[model samples]
Each structure stands twice: as C-alpha cells, then as structure tokens.
Target: LPASQQEHIFNAAWGGSHKTGQLICNACNQSFSTNVDEVFSLYTTAIMNAWSFKGQRHKSVPIIELDGDYVLEAGAKLRIKPEKPLFEEKNLPNGQIRTKISFNSKGEAKRWLNNGGAESWLGRSLTPEEREYLLSLIKESEPQRREPEPQEASTTLNLRNQYRSSAHTILKCLGFFLPDLVCSPLTQPIRQFARYDEGDWRLFAVEPEQFFSLGEEITNLLGLGVYHNSVEIYWSSSSRMIVGILTLLNRVKRAVIISNNYAGSDKILYVFEDTNLSKKPPTAILAEIDSSKFCQPLLGVQYFAQPTKMYEYFYNELVGLTSIYNPIDAMKAELIKSLEEVNKHHTTLEGSTIDQYQTLYLNFFIKLGKVLQVSVDSVKIDSKLQEYGFSRLRLELKGRNITDPEVESIIVQAFDSVLSDWTQNRL
Candidate 1:
C-alpha cells in the first residue's frame, strides 16, 4: 500500500512466540494481521482502494482557444460561463452617463461586440466618433416659440406653457433624443421607379397639409392625423390612395384599378423584383396616367438604384470567404467547377466542413436550377462526418456520387438550358 512518507514499522518480531502478530501502519494509524496470507490481502486491498477524483476549480480558469480545424459532433453541447462584468456606469461632467468599462481583452470584447451587443450595452467607453455624434444631438436647441411677456403671466404659467415644459422634461428623462437610445425606424417597403422611357413613375407625397384647419369649420369635420402618399391625379383635386399599388405591380405586370376619389387617372406603377432584364416580365403591368402637370418627384429619388439587401448579403459572404482563403480567384474557380458538376449530377453531395461548402453549393445550385427552369425537390448538401465540423480547409467534395443515368441526363439537360446565362454571368 502507498503510504505517507512518515510511515514506519511500529514493531516486528519473527519467532514462534509471536506466531500471529499485529502489524501497524503509522501512516493510516491502522493495524493489520501480520500472518503471511492475511497481510498480503490487507496490503492488496489498501493499494487497490478507489479514490474519488477532485477536479480543479473551473471558475478561475480561462477558456482555452479552440483549434482552427476542430470538428464538433452534430449533437455537441457547448457551455460558456460568462466572465465577471468589467464595467459600471460612470456619470460624466457634461451630465452624460458614460461606461466605466474599457477594453481589457480586445479579441474577446470584439467578438462579443460583433454578436449584436453594442458597445453601450457592454458598458464600454464611447469612441470619439460616438461621443461627438451624441454631443451634437444633446446640445439644446433655441426655443422656436416666443416667451410670454412679464405682464401676461402675473401668477402661474398658462396650460400651453405647462405642456411645452412637460414635453421637454419627458424628452430629457426618456433620453429619446440620445444617441442609440431610440427604437429603430420602421422598415419601409421596397421602392423602385418604373422606367419605361425618359419619364418614370414613382410614389410621391404631397405638401404636408393640416388635417384639421385650426380655426376653420373643417376642424369640426376632420380629426387631426398625418397624411401619407397623397397625390394629385387631376387638376381638379388631390386624394389619398392605398399603398396597394405596390402589391399590384408586384403580382401583375399590367392592371388598371379606378380611384373613386380621383377622376383623371387609374394607372398603377410597374415594379418587378427581378435582378436581371432577360427574365420574363410578370404577366401584369400597373401604370398610372397623371393628367395633372403639377405632380413632381419626391426628394431622394435619385439615390434609389442601389442593389437589394440580398445581393449585399451575398457580396459579404464572398468577401468573408476570400478573407479566410486568399487568392479567391482559385477558390472561385474551384467552387464554380464543383457547383456546375453538382448541378449536372442533380444529386446530394457531402462536404468536409458542412457550413461553408454546403451553404455555397446550395445557394448556387438552387439559383442555377431556378435560372434553368428545372424545379428540383430539394438541394442536397450532407456533412462528410455525421457530426458538425468547423475546419474550412478542405475543398473537394468527398462523398457518394449519384450514378443514375436518367437523373444525370435530366441534370445535363437543365445545365444545357441555362448554359448561356451561366456563361454570361461567369464573365
């Protein structure tokens, strides 16, 4: 038995007088039979004793960096215990509350920041840019309304004056005007100008008109509310039109719906969601005839030609992949060849790192099939390993190949159908 260094034999006597003796192990302070057979069993039992494992304190240790090529199983569960918060709120001299937190671990902090936690949420100190932008908004504006004369307010403030003061107080208390404090603006529907020739039709708003004329009889007839998309169809009068015109243009290439309130025009604008020109235009077209010469384009119409968000997302993905693997042209070529082959086979393929190649192949395959007009049931992209893999170094597709003659021919036909579009797009 393994014993403490302090262990020593208490006593030992080998003779007939001490035929069956007791042996003392000073380490454990326990006595055992000194008879040959029993002593061997006692020593064996002590040596073979099982001790429960005492693990190190997990809270104090930092997480080790994960391997770049580490592959995790599909059912893997990752647990991350957050570190102590490093920052607290600190009031600034300018009455703005700043964060006490500074970037102690830049890499980890950056990752945390990128995962939708703004610096303010992290209680991090503001950058100079943020500080300047905030300061500009926070600076008080000169009062637009005239102050009450001393003679007029002999006692308490009037109701109007009280309301203004209350509003100002509320704005300050709620931090409505503070940078990054307000809710995000509402999402506007996609807007596009239907260009037929030199003249293009677009949605426009009329000059802001009061819904309730303050002192006029119309005030009794109409309640106060903001008006939107109020356009003049004829020289006679202006009326409110439903934004349904956008939906009509999306569904049908051509459709005419009468506007009951407005007499002169019944045409709706045409706006298709296509990214290319050769794609067949939707069967319906919506166009409006404006007999009134007074209709003018709204402000900021010239800057509406930017690509849709989907395209931007695609660009971002490509840029990210390029950054990870430099000389992207080679990767692009390899990807194109592999994607074309996958399209040609019309079968599922497994990838080493499922996230990257799977996404890339599925997107390309689906899009290619769409352009070719062959609607497949689903794009197949399986993982090479049953579990999830993180490494992205592998390029070759390394799984089962579809050998069905009929399916292969069908894929070839689809590829041939979109060959022109593919070639043009590749260039």
Candidate 2:
C-alpha cells in the first residue's frame, strides 16, 4: 500500500493521539471497521457513557437505553421515555372518577392533552369548561417522581468478529511498532486471519488472571487511572510468541497472539491513553520483557475449544466491571472508600466533616434503596433498630470521637448486614 492509502492502526474513537501514522492499508482498515470495529465501538461506548469516559470524537455523553421506559444519560441520570401516557384510574366511594396520568415530562402531557388525549380517554368530545379544568388540574398537580433501577444495556456481539478485530489491531500495532516482524512468514497466519478471514485460528484470549495482573502493572507505570485505553505488544521468549493485549476504558480486555513461531529477541511496546482527554496524550513506552517474570503459557491455534471460554470470560468480566450490572456492590465499594477517606483525613469527625460524611452516606443509601426496590422516602436512618445495620451505623457514629480500629470493623459489619438483607430479596 502507498503512503496515501495507509490508515491509523489504533481506532480514532479510542482518543489515542498516535493515530496520525500510516500503519495499515486503507482497504484493510476500512474492512475491519465495517466488519468488526463498529460493533466493538458500540459495545465499548455503552460502558464509556456509563463510566463517563470521554473520547476524542464523542466528547459529549451518548444516551444509552435501559430496561423498560427509561434511558440512561451520560452522567448516570435515568430519564423515563414512555412511548405513551400512562394512566391509572380508580372509582372513589363518592362515585367520582379519580385519574392519574404519567408522561415523560410535563410538556409531553400538555402536548398530548392539546391533541385531544383527554377526550379520547373520556370517549367523547369535552366541553370548553371540562378541557380547561383538566388543563388546570394537570398544571396544579405535582409530578410524581420515581427512581428507575439501573440496568445494564443489552448488547449482542459477534464473537468471531470481535476476535478478528482484536487480532487485526494487534497486526496494525506490529506494523507501526515492530515493522521488521510484521511481514515475516511467522506472522502470515495472523495477517491472513485478520485481513482475509482465511483461518480458523484462536486469535484472542480473555484470561482475567493474566490480564488483571499485568494490567495493574501497566496502568501503575503509565499513571493511567481507572478508565483508560491501552495496547501492549511484546515477544515472549518462553512461549516463543509475539503477543498483544488490547484494553478499552480499562474494562474490556483481549489478548491476541500476533505470531506463535517467532524468532526474535525480547521486544515490548506499550501504548496507552487516558480516556479523560484533559489528562495526557497517547504515549508509547519501550521496554525489554524479562523471560523469568513472564511465565504465561502460549495460547496456540491448536486450542479449538478456547473460543467458547473466551466468550464467556469476556462477558463475565464486563458484568463485574460495569456498575449498572452490579450497582449494589459498586455502591458498597464507593461507600467504603468514602468512609476510608474520611477516617484517613479527620482524627475525629465533626462539624463540616461530619456533614460531608453524612452527605456521602445518604447518597449511597438512596442508590442502595433503588437497587433493593425500596422507595426513596423509606430510605431513612431509623433509631429503633438495635442491630448495627445500615440505619444503625449512622446512630453509632453520632457524637462519637471514636477513630480507631473499630471503625473498620463497624463498616464491615454494616456492609455484611446490608448484603444479607439484599440477598434475602435476591437482589
């Protein structure tokens, strides 16, 4: 391919700064985008929107669909988007009809009413007096507020396409970073599989144990916080394979085999970018892989059954990482972190500090209530309970200058009790 026909190795949607280079041919790059990158982008964007990971192109939060008549916005705000007005009618004992209406917004209700919504429900044309009265009632009545439970957006992905896309990226990374080995005979299998879809090779693996352990080390070194995009390419001497790992928003992970029968010295190229655009630009790190430190077994093409395991493991990791799928645990972890921060800063919580802690506590409780299917109004710290549970924890901390080891114990106990109660409801 000529220079003009070359395309970016890293997807620009990932907000990587190193996208300027000519790494792959335009035809092959466009093919990957059409076949696999689009679906991969959609899958990652849902998580990115939920976690607020801003990309280069998608600077604004994209609206994502949730369960029922709700849609989740960028900042985790759930907005109801009912297709039609919901009404609940009851016969009062005084022979009067009591009606309640629900709409996505007050404006929607007005528009529906203006377009003869009320008359259709009444089964007759309304008089001027009745129409005016209904409008007045709608204006005066306070809108009922209900919190929608957070649910993970459902996504259908072609596993074969995902595997191919991952391998294609690895090949592009190789072309950009390790040009010498990219066109070698050993890499032909990967190239053919990624570009032409000519092989039934196991192109990728989703081994959480290997991914997380190495991911921690890479993130720590790069100072890329919780949500970031990363790609690592290295030659494994023990396995005699050139491997690549791709991570998006620090959540989606894939390990791709670039070449299994490589004859090269140890080489490492780690590229990463913080999804939060304000922090840093894309960076490339060079290092040598120590054979002793890298003992991960090579995943060769002979393992035909590994693809099924990879699919299962990928979804399992996704569910655990996304907060919507596991809000209770997410909230619990956040609450624990908040308490720990408070304990670390203040010797004895008082005044504004106490207020801050209470604010965090209340916010957590409100979310927990929604997850538990309990109304927000019922999420209160009742003093009648003797057990040191959610409600009792606040009372236990009141006016106490206790900032010792017992604080941790109390937190653990409170979380355990809450978990027990939550599990009782099968939440």
Candidate 3:
C-alpha cells in the first residue's frame, strides 16, 4: 500500500481521532463512506445528537426533523418551522371580524405584522385609518408555558447496508490492530462482501433471545453509558471462529462473523470511544485472552441457513431496544438537568427546594422501576429509607427550617443511600 492509498478506517462520525494507515485504499474508503457509512449514520442521527457526539469532521449536532412542523435543534431544543404565517379570521353576523395569529416568537410576530401580513390576510390594501384601528384593537398576549411531551417520528433504514457497514468497521479495526490477519486470505470473503457487496455472506448474527441480556452484562462490566461506542474483535481457538461485536450507544448490538475456520492463536482487540469526552482520543486494547472466553457457538453455518428469519429477529431486537432505551435516556437527561438547576440555586434550601428534590427523586425512581419491571411505591421506598436509618429524616425535612445544617446532611445521605441501592442491585 502506497502513502496516497492509505486511509483511516473508522468513521469520523463515531467520535474518534483520524489515523490513516494501509488498512483500505482511498477509493474503497470513499465508496464505503458514500454507500454504507452514510446510511448507518443517518439511521443513528437521533442517538448521536441526543448524546451530543461530535466527530473529527462533523463538529456540530445536525438538525433532526420531527413529525409535525418542528425540528430538533442543538439536540434538545425544539424549533417550530411552519410553512407560512398562522392566521385565521372569522366574520360575525354582528358586523364584527375576529382574527387570530400565532408565531413562534414575539419578534417573528412583529416581523410578520410589519411585512404586509395584515394586508395579505385582509385581502386588500390597508388605509392609514384602517391600520390605526387594527393596531388599536390588537394586544400582545403573554407567552404560554406547557410541559414537554413525547415526540413521534418514523425513519426508514436499510438494515442490510447497516450490517455491511458494521462488518466493514470491524474489518478496518482488524487492519489497524492486526494487519497481517486482515490481509490474509481468510478475510477475503469479508472484504468482498463489505467493500463491493458481492457475496451472499451472513455478515452479522445475534441470538435473538439472549442478545439484550448479554449486552446488558457487557455494558455493566465496561461501565459504559448509552452514549459510548465500542467494538470487540477476537479469535476463539475453541470455536475456531473470528467474531466482532459492535455496540453503539450501548443500545444497538450486532456480532459480525469475520471467519469461521481460524488457525491463529487467541487474540482480542477492543476499541472504544466515550462520545461524551470529545477531547479524548479513542482507546484501543490488544491483549491475550483465554482461547475459550469469547467463543460463540451460535455462529455456526447452520445459524446462517435461514437468512430471512435471522434478519427479522435482528430487526425486532433493534426496535425493541430502541423503544426501551430512548425514553430512559431522556428521563436520565431531565434528571441531570434538574439536579444542575438545584445546584445553581443552592444558597437557600426552602420547602419548595425540598419538594423539587423529592419530585426529581420520585420521577427517577419511577423510571427505574419501570425499566426493572418492578413495582415501586412510597412504602417500598420508605422501607429502604428505614434500612438506611433515614426514615425519620424524610418527615423532618418537611417541618424543619430551610437553614438547618443537620436536615441538609440527612437529605444528602438519604439521596446517596438510594443511589447506592440502585447501583448495587441493578435497579
């Protein structure tokens, strides 16, 4: 491989530093970016934006279109994008006309009112007297505040292309970490399928029932959040197979089969990027592991016999995990935001402050209960509080003065106790 032909194997969108090598030719890199990488990136835009992940090239979060006349901006902020000014006029029998106009902001309303919007709605030129009368009748209304609600959106994805992209990514990692193995004849089929889409190869696989459970265990072991991106490649001597597992946001998991009959010694390469820490470069680990540690019995040839069934199973698994994790992530974000707000106003702890903290705690516990498939109520929470010797603190928090140092200490300890239980018991 020449210097000009070498290219960085990892996609910049996955939050990593760029390192060019002889892993892939420049032409193949560009082609894969156009065909495979773009599709997978589009499919993961929401998750990427939600986590505020910025790549080497893409430094800002992209706008996400919603179901209605709104687009998500800067990840969480919603902006209304109506096609036209919102205007309605009703003529009454008593020789009166009632008009209504809506705008996203007061400045927008003022701009529209000055830019012939009134004349357009009236369908005629406005005389000085008419304009003055309209101005006199119109009054500015106060802004309305409402609680945030869930948003619904639909996205069409090509799972086949995404699978290919995953396989290609694994191949790139191998090229960077184990160049000889990636260049060997054993990886030729993967190269043909991932680069040119030439073979009917079973590129990705998962045990439909055990995939999520296994993913959760791995996530806990790695101390990874939903925003982290990680990939693992290992050759299992016992199973005589080379497999690669790709995880995005700790939500989407897929195992790519790189080789079925391997003759090399046991090797494991793990690469990960914490999207939250954009300044840090991605980490790569090449280590020796037990020959039997990462073996997958389910990736045998028989598993690929029914491609349609496998695809369907993978599709359903993706959808189910997305539905379950997205909302929890949102809730977690809200909890963090609320906590920041509390810290910002920490000078005085009033009754309202206690109430706000309790509200935040209740909301988080409810979400945790739902995720754990457990019923949680005040009684159960109080029982835990009793175990922690904070049962009396809860009652004292209500009646005690806001300036009491002991009260604050008790509340903090109780909060810590709850969090400890959650982490220890998998709540």
Candidate 4:
C-alpha cells in the first residue's frame, strides 16, 4: 500500500473511529503463550475499564473571576477580605496547602455564565466568620448525614426520582451497568460509603442555594445526599471508590448527579459502557451490592484542570481567603454603589404623569430593597432617585397603560444593570 493510503487506514481505524484500534504484534504471527496471554488479558481489562467516549461532549466555558467582594443581583455589595486565615495549619491535613488564587474557564462554568452575566460572581470568598454566617443564611447548605435505616424495599426508580430509601437500588443500577466497577474494589466490603447524585455535572462546587438561586440558568441539581433535601452524603470510608465509578458511567439526559462536590468538578472520563444510546433504552438495574453503602445516580461527573483538588481550590482559594465586609455602616456602601450604578445606566421614566413615574420608580426600588434586604420607604426611594437626577417630569400618554408587567420588565432590567456594575467594581 502507498504511504498515504496506509496513513489514511491507520487514522480511520484508530483516530476517527473510537470503537476499534489496531495492535501491532512485534513477534511471530502465532498466538500468544499462556503467560503473555494472561498479561495481555489484564491489560485489555484495564483498557476496557478506562475507555470513555463521552469526553467528546466536554465543553469548557469562561470563568467568572471573583477577585474580592461579592455583589448581589439586587445591587448589594459585600466586601470580603478576611482578617486572618480561616483555618490554621493544624486544622488542615499535613502537607495540604490551600489552592492558589487564579482564573479559569472550564466545565459547568459554561452553563452558569451562559446568560452572559446573570448568574456569575465577581468573587466567591468569605471569612471564616462569613462562612459561618452564610451557612446560617442558607441553612440547608451543609446537612449532617443521617444514620441509614434497615435496607428497605428497592425500587426500579430512574435516576431522577430516587431517594434515601432507593439508595441500594441506585447502587444496583450502577453495578448492573458496569459490573467490573464493583468487582475491582479500592477498599473492601463496599457497604460503608454514602452516595450522592449530581445531575448535569458542572466544574465548580457552588452551594445548592446559590446555584439554584440562578433559577433556570442552573437546570440540574447538585448533590442530593442522605439528608432528604441535602446535597452531601456521609458513609463509611470503605465504599468511597464506588462513587468514582459512578462518575465514570454514562450520563443520563435531564438527570442530576449527587455529590458534596459540584457536578463537573472533575475531569469526566467517558467510559464507552454503552455506545448505541439512540437505539437502546437507558441502562437500568436492581440488585443489592452492600448493606451498609447507599447509592445516588449521577446525571454526570465533574472535572477541572485538577479534579481531585477542585474542592480544596474552591474552599481555600475562593472562599477561605475572602471575608464578607458587612460594615455596620453599610448605608454608605449601598448609597454609593447604587448612586454609581444609576449614573452609568439610570432608568428613565417611560410613562406619563407623576403617578405613572412614581409607580414605576417605586416598584423598581421596592424590588431592589428586597434583594438588598432593606425596607423600601417610598418617600426615601423617591428622594434618592431625585438625587440621582431621575426626572419625575410627566410625558403625554400615547401608548398602552403602564401596567405591573411593564414596571416589572423595567425594574428587572435596571436591577441587572445596576447589580452588574456593582459586581464589576468589586472585582
């Protein structure tokens, strides 16, 4: 064969087609001996265990750099600069250093930032005190794992609807789909680990409350642990490797993976466990793996440049080093942030008459007040708008009535614009 034809054949067989590859035997054309066959068999097993094609869909998105403070969607600014280290060296494991501060765009960030700037943060850091405070703010952020009840009746529930009672069923499903995973145990007696399901895996580990707060921007739920509404699962250490195998399994569309870490926080290894996805129904199973361990199905797994270290990076580099500078005198911060915001993209009165203007302006401030967690005194808000040069000058009524819907549209847009500015300044 000509060299070009040979090259074409090799690329077509190995590179273009993931289903097959050519192995060049160096020795004679005869079949392998027993010892060599054994070694090769194990090699093929390892290869089969690690082979994945889902990597083709891995799309990296931009990172929203939270350089310093956190700004809310309602234009509230939180200056986060920690006064001291959140955790001392003794508190962390020996030789475990905090991840360094840096910017990145990979994994779930693509989905989070897909709205351009709606669900992003300039910074995500918090002081130890702020971290505790935020824990209180979002009460369900960290849930304690509950003791597992007696192995209940397992169900044939799909990945989306499974619960604590269905954990064993999920494990069975995992084992059914990929039996080799259960056979090769990193730790013995696989019944001791807890399971989580994160649907539509993303890279960064944002708390459920914050991630969900983005509304439609974040479609799938991250980690649903043992606590019924919680996202973290605590199980015995022995079966931990099972979760890693679940991450390697094929992703189910529209389902979430449960985990302490955010979905897509790890580099996803696409095991081509089943390739004929369009033709075949999704893989399902029902068999008990271990009595002590629980399982939660994953929509998919997460990955970053460094998968294992993503949690550390988020905690230490993003949240630990930053403080929530909630000053007792936040009035000035609020006033200035809002003032600066209005100057850039101030709202104009689109309705005629003082009543229309007042209604629209009042509604905008009221919306803002809720986000800033402050009272919207109508008089004070009017005065503030006047100070920012928003004219209450009436216009002639020519178009449709300025209803609540119009006011809502105007206010939401203004809120996003002002908040975007406030957040940009903090960064």
Candidate 5:
C-alpha cells in the first residue's frame, strides 16, 4: 500500500493476506469475492487496460498510454471492504478516500495520484518506447496485416461456395481466417459492428462505408463464425439483419458483445487475434481474445506504465507457477502461510528487530518453500542473539533445476501448458 492510495472504486490489496474480502461495484451492481489481491489485480489490470487502448489511433505501431479519461466517470465508486466485520468503506488517516483499502489499518494506503502524477487511473504515463514494448507484451499469437480493403463481397451461391472452399484451403494452409470489423465511418452492418464491444479498454474507429462492407466481406469470405472446421450459418428476421448478426456473433465471442446496445461506430475497431499457418485445427480456428479479468481495467490506467506494475505483471506471467489457471494466487499464497503461523506463535515481529533463533527459524521454514516448489524471496528474521546482535534472514527466490530428469520434464510440460492457456494469441 502506498502513502497516498485511495479507491474511488476499490483498489484491492486483496491477496497479500488471506482473511477473504468483498468487491462491490455499485454501478455494475455486482458483488463477489474469491481472494482480495487476486481479484483486485485482475480488476485493475482489466479496467486500466481499457483506458490504455481506447480512443487511440490504430497505427502500425502502438502508442502505449492511457486512452485518456474517457473511463473516469464522476461518482463511480467501486469499493472493496472486509466482509468479516461487515463491509466497511475505509478512509485514510488524513480523511482521504482510501479506495485501495488496506486491511492492516496502515496509514500508507491511499490513492495512486496522492504521490503526485497524472489525473489518471494509474497516476502516471510511460515513454513511447516502453509503451510500445508493453503493448507487444499482450501476446498476439497471429498478427493481422492491413492490405487494400476487399470490395463488397458478393455471396451468390457460386461466390459463397468459392469462399467456403477458400476457407477450407486456408485451413489446409494451417490457420484460420479472422474478420475484425473496423466501424469508424459507419456504413455496412453497423449494428453488428456495434455488437462487438471491448469491455474494459476502448478501441480505434473505422471508416464509415467499411461497416456493412466488412460484414459482407466476413459473410462472404469466412462464412459465419466457425465451430470446429464447420462454419456457423445464421440468419434471423428479428430486429434487422444487423441485430441478428450481432445476436449470433455474441454467441461466438463475448469480448465483442459489450456496451449493451451498439454505440454508433465512432470508436470501435476489432483485432483478429490469431491464425496458425500450419496444422489445421479440426475445430473453428478461433481468433478472438478470451475475456480476461487481467486485461479489462489495467490497460486503461497510467499506473500500468509504472516500473512497479511492470515487475508485478512480469512476476506473475514469467514467474508465477501458481496464478495462471487457478485465478486465485492460491498456490504461492498457500505456501506463504507458514509466516502467519509463525506470527501467531511468536506474536510480535515488526519494527527494527531481529530473530534470536536464526538457525531454528531457517531450519523449520527452509523446507516450506521447497515443498511448495517456489523460492522464498527474502525472509526477514528479527530479535538479537546473544553476541551476534539481531540478524535478518533474507532468501531471494531462486530457480532451481529438479534433480530428477523425468520429473523435470513433467514440470516443464505443466508450465508450458499453463503458459499456452493463459496467453492470448494476438499480434
């Protein structure tokens, strides 16, 4: 927690300690909890991400910065409170709003801006190069290239058959075709284009005539969305073809179905996430980002540009052996718990002190992190021993090779699987 942390909407320090908590979004009318730190991280990342990408130009290169203050609506209060003693909206010592409320009752926890920065959700900005680098971190498995726009696609039986054949041929080429509609100028299938929304972050806009034209191209080019190698053909008279197209596309990708009703095409552009050029999938060549709790908010804020956030995200993605699929930082956290148990028995261990029983403490907790298979990064021991004076126990997280070769292979495979699942195939 920082000295100036605050939560207009709750900035959850949720997972650091394990008492359990609550996140209540009054505007969204939603309240839920799993672990505090995990949830808050996910929320911050997702929401801030929206601010990062929204309203920016879709240049060949990304300008990694906040999408401006489009998301900071006044009067929005996302609060996280201690569910144990009944939910309470916490306040800072100086009576400031501590939106990222802390359970420890520490004076530091306040708002990101209190330390002096931008009028931003994350309170800071990144340089052009760094921002571009972070945007690349978004893992685009397949990068989409822009070419001269294809003409209005004609779906005559012959053309449809040819397109269908072309689709299969592309599959044989070992990848799927993706249809990302850029609805800036708003011409064709504007309604269906509107249906595709980016929830947390915002998007760049498309030219007007490009709307229905893109929809027509998608209708003719890839058929409808795929389900396995088979394409999904949908047509309904309900609400216009625009509404019908949206209704169907919603079932195909939830990430595109935000904003309830389409908000005219002044500000939305879709990215076709992936397509492999080898080994055709037997199923729909899926090429959309799965709705991520991590991406929703963080991209929208300036804080994501900070060094601290960079380290935190890196720690999770490259080093997190626990949080990927589990969502709850449970594994790393579960292993950390020995400290709490020690805290109970030993009672007090804070301030400038040293542990007298250095050897005993190390010997007992030494096997703890090893058992969990994650390194313990710097453990502090307080209390002065007889002549040596108070000593600190510092253990930096170290990556070690497992002694057994076969077990090492299995661990590596598990790690690979986790990485594959968590990473979005976007470019």
Candidate 6:
C-alpha cells in the first residue's frame, strides 16, 4: 500500500470511521462502538499516549517552544507535551502553532504537539531544579501554552494550586536521593529516564510543593508501584527497576491500564511488579501475560519504535502498580469502577467564581423544581433543566427587577455546585 494509504489505515484502525454501523473485529468479535466520535477520541488519546504526534492546537492555538525541535511540554493542567520538535510555526490571531509536521525522527512529535502537546526536552538543557521551577510557573501562568490567555493562564495556576491534592497521581517526580543502587535503569525505553548529566543521580530531592512552585515544565516518568491519593515510591536494589505509589485526587478515582505489553509477545503485561523474597510485595498489578503467546500484540505495537525498551520498562516498572488500590471485596467494587473516567474529567468544588456560577444553575433548577412542585421526592430540578430555557430565565431575571442580587447570589452558589451535582447525578 502507498504511504498515504498506510497512514490512513493506521489512523482508521486506531479510530473507527465516522459512519456508524455494526462491524465485528475477528480479533475481538465483540462489537466495538461504531460511533465515530468515540473511536476518534480514544484514537486520539492512544496516539497522544505514545508521546509522538506533532504540534496541534488545543482551542486552535499552537504552544510555546523552547527550541527548534524541543518544546516546553504541557500537561492536562497543561495537556502533556509530546517528543517532537523542529516543526513549522504559524502565528494565528490569538496563538502560535506548528504549521507542518511529518514523520520526523522522534516518532512524529508534531502529531503529539498538535494534540495539545508541546516539545519535550531530553538530555541536559537545564537542571531538574531549574526545569521544575519553570514548570511550576507555567502551570500557574501557562504563559507560553498554545493560545494561552492572561485569564486562562492565571486561572490554570490557581486551579492547579488549589486542587493540587496529592491524590490520584498518575506518576511521581523523583528526587536525586534514590538509593545509589536504587537508581533508575540506565537503559529504560521510556523517554522519562533519558540519562541526565551522568545518569540521573541526585544528592537532593525537592519537596513536591516546592518543586511545583518553581513553575517550569516536567516530563512524566513511569515506574511500577502503588499510586493512590498519597503518592509514594520505592525501588529494587538491583536498580534494574523501580516502583511508585500515588493517590489521585478524588476526581480521578483510578487510572485504568486498558492494555499493556511486556516481554516480546511471550508475556502478557499484567503483574504490576514482580516480587521475590528480596524484592518485597509490589503495589499494583499492571498486566497478566500468557508468556507463551506474546507475539501478536507486538505486530500492531511495532510502529511504536523501541518496543523492547517500552515493553521491558512496562514489565519492570509498571506491573502490579494498581492492585494496591483494588478494594478488599473486588466483586463489589466493580460497580464503581465504571465511574473512574467520569472522575478523571470532573472537578470537585472549592469555593470559587466558577463554583458560584454553578450555584446559579442550581437555583434555576430549584425554582424550576418548585414550579413543578410536586412531591419532595418527585421533583427533579436538574432532570428538566434546559440550556436555552434556563438562559432565558436568567435574562428575564435581569431584564426585569426579579433577578435581584440575592437571587443572583443564590444563582452563583447553585452554579458553583452545579457541576459537582452533574457529575454526582450526571443531571
């Protein structure tokens, strides 16, 4: 097939076509969702996960770059950066963007960059300390993000700091103090472990709060371990591998490792970490493998480049990383597992203007409920809420004298809590 056709097929395989219909994959036979949007969303995320892809816009703006190829990556707080560089940039009215990105070396960074990513810095450009500072400032200000606005930058910082719960941590930042023998493997495939100066040896480890305060960009490094609301880490003595544990905020109840691979296709990437009398118990289980039949996944995964390292690191650093958070009664807990994704995207309220706006919506729901005013249990204010109708109510409130400050204040509070309720009830 032609390269263009191959790329199109590759993109399609990752994300299905927009034309929805019943289709069966011989591989799974189970019907995959025929929805184009769902397919594309997951495709985008999976591609984004590869840490490839070139520069794309978030709301249509390109991000800041540190060099021709290297860019200051952004996280979800900034929408993580990819490993791309040296793409063209175009100055949009509101932001800058990379105009062209092809399959260049670092596995098509422009793709990732375009998908809410920036450039990645490997090797030594600055000390971890220096980078950490700039990352913190960027999180707070995000002054250099794709199409970042003054208000958005300031708001991003405030939200990060405010909700900066050490809960639901996907990965942890490491300090140089890892036991000399506990140092990260020298040749991990994952880019997070690229050797710095002389192998990432550090005499000092910065505090998490202090580190983020520095306001620079940070690269995400993966390790096997238990991550919960309180993130922590430990490593094996051989230095061949390490594990970490963390606590995600309440919002991100848990991270579901949808699929992972380790050991050529011979081993299924399950056990989050291997344990021995010397190694101690691990924190979570990343995959369960059929060590015997491990080749096929490799077929599709080959395009990922450096599969050995990625898989090796997967086995060594990310297996059994999740079992730590599994509930004692596994069967019963399954009920809540489905909500994990919802938690990931929603925010819990802390009194803020956004929260205030939520309160207004709640009041609308409440007033609407009263209009329907039936039984205490029967009136579902949110269920009947309509976007256009509600806005009309708000304008009518203000258009006349009925929407007084007291009513407005009530609306604001309801608005603040609205999202929380929506997530809670999906109302």
**CA lDDT, every prediction?**
0.27, 0.62, 0.65, 0.28, 0.25, 0.27
Candidate that would win on TM-score: 3
What TM-score would you give candidate 6 relative to the actual structure? 0.19
Compute the lDDT for candidate 3.
0.65
User: Tens-digit lDDT track for model 5 on 288-327?
Assistant: 2222322232111122345476447435532232123122
RMSD of candidates 1 onward, in order? 39.3, 8.0, 6.4, 26.8, 26.3, 25.1
> Per-residue lDDT of 319-409 in model 4, one digit per residue for the tens?
2112111121133234434444543442443443334444555665565565456665677555544433333233322242333345434
lDDT of 4 at 197: 28
- Which is the leading candidate under lDDT? 3
Tens digit of lDDT per residue, candidate 1, span 39-95?
121111111111111111112112222233221111111223235436688788999
Candidate 4 has an lDDT of: 0.28
List the candidates ranked by TM-score, beginning with the highest: 3, 2, 4, 6, 5, 1
- Tens-place lDDT per residue, model 6, 1-427, is 1112111101122221121112112221111212111222321322222222221223321233322333323211223335434456587887765364333333343344334344343333555675566445434441223453222110011111111111111221222122232233432322122111122211111112111200111111232111111223322222212223222211121111111222122211111211111222223322333423533221121221354753463343222221111111121122223233333443442234223343444444443333334222223444333242334444444333323455434443443354355436644
Distance from true position, residue 23, model 6, in Å? 52
lDDT (Cα, tens digit) per residue for candidate 2, span 159-252? 6677677777667666665677777898888778777877764544433224224445878655465456777776656567777778766657
RMSD, model 3, all Cα superposed? Answer: 6.4
How many Å off is the CA of 258 in candidate 3? 1.0
Q: What's the candidate order when arranged by decreasing lDDT? A: 3, 2, 4, 1, 6, 5
Q: What is the lDDT of candidate 6?
A: 0.27
State, as a TM-score between 0 and 1, how close model 1 is to the true structure.
Answer: 0.16
- Compared with the true structure, what per-residue lDDT tens digits does model 3 show for residues 1-427? 5547445455666654455646666788778877887765653565665554565667577567788767766534566655565678899999999877766666666666678988787798989898766555444457665444556766776766776888888887777667798888888887777888876645444332221233345566676766567777766665678888777666666677788778767666777766554545456777665535434432233344576886687667656644554445556666767866885776555556666777777777877686667776755565565555355555445556544778656665666687687768733
TM-score of each: 0.16, 0.66, 0.72, 0.22, 0.17, 0.19
